[model samples]
Target: MKWYGASQRRGTLSRLAPDGKDVKAVTLYTHTFFLIEDGRSDEQKQPHYTAVGATPEEAEAMAFAVYQRAMDCNHAMQQKGPMLIECSHCGIQRRVLLPPAPPVAVTRKAERRFFNLF
Candidate 1:
């Protein structure tokens, strides 16, 4: 038995028999994901935004929309924190964090070369 995703958004769970035949199969319908989290303040009861979508791209789009809204509503001073994505089927979760900033380049003073031709 193996669980795999179909061409469409939904997934399919199929079982193979000894003769290489599909004995049983089940199609699991995909559900809309409602990912929400409070920014900066964990004590807040309400989340900063509620991102909803059935696919990952959709969810990201929704998140981006909310992000824009936050920027406009809060003068572009929105809090940044780790976001969570949970799987509705197996209850698996993953956290997305911001990457570290690039290192700064340090410039050194060039040593003066002596040109004495006495």
Candidate 2:
């Protein structure tokens, strides 16, 4: 009835079901993702990055790693430039493209403003 995290790196929490089988619940924010064209055209892509990941620190590190790899692939491709990066799930390893990094939410302190007509 309850689940606990298996580890920090893994994004899963598991528990036993009524039938004595393992029920693995995929934890949010633990999947790795990057920006790529969604087949819209040759030069334009969807205006968003796919999201997934690990811990805050780990996720940032992973995203940066993908960026680095993409840069390498870009050099190899030459004129084709960049736009594809390797995916962990996909088997074809010629590689794919990745952009710099995913956008992060900005947190700021709220400021209360009042009319000060003196």
Candidate 3:
């Protein structure tokens, strides 16, 4: 997907490690996934983050995994959708819309503030 910032750009499917070692034909299989490596490591060899999938189906399942991982990695992460898919070949991007979160319960004390207006 077309993310708005440079950092987001780095998180695209194109930047993900291929399912295999073949550099020429890198296909994102079901197991092919990406992860946001922990950035706290002092050694450069330690991955800042990582994502993986075991099968094509797993890859699809991991879409949400990655999104959650990103959110967990950065609480400020604001994505338009809960899941996103990008085709490395044609550069097509699609997003999977998650069901809206349940409305929060308002406490009686908070409700009283609005009642005064009524």
Per-residue alpha-carbon lDDT of candidate 3 for residues 16-69, written as tens digits (9 for 90 to 100): 455666544344443222332354333222212223444455554555455544
**Span of ten consecutive residues with least summed lDDT in model 1:** 1-10
How high is the CA lDDT of each candidate model? 0.38, 0.37, 0.38
Q: What lDDT is obtained when candidate 1 is compared to the true structure? A: 0.38
Is candidate 2 or 3 superior in TM-score? 2
lDDT of 1 by residue, 11-114 (tens): 22334445455454433223222223333322222223334454555655655554444433422223333554433333323345567879999999987767
What digit string (tens of lDDT, one per residue) describes model 2 on residues 1-118? Answer: 1112111122433334354465554444442333344433322322112224545555545544544454334322222236533334321123345757988999998776677543
State the lDDT at 1 in candidate 2. Answer: 12
Residue 58 of model 3 has an lDDT of 54
Alpha-carbon TM-score of each model against the true structure = 0.26, 0.28, 0.21
- For model 1, give the RMSD to the true fold: 14.5
Instruction: Give candidate 1's error at residue 72 in angstroms.
Output: 1.8
- Residue-pair clashes per candidate: 0, 8, 14
Q: Which candidate has the top score in TM-score?
A: 2
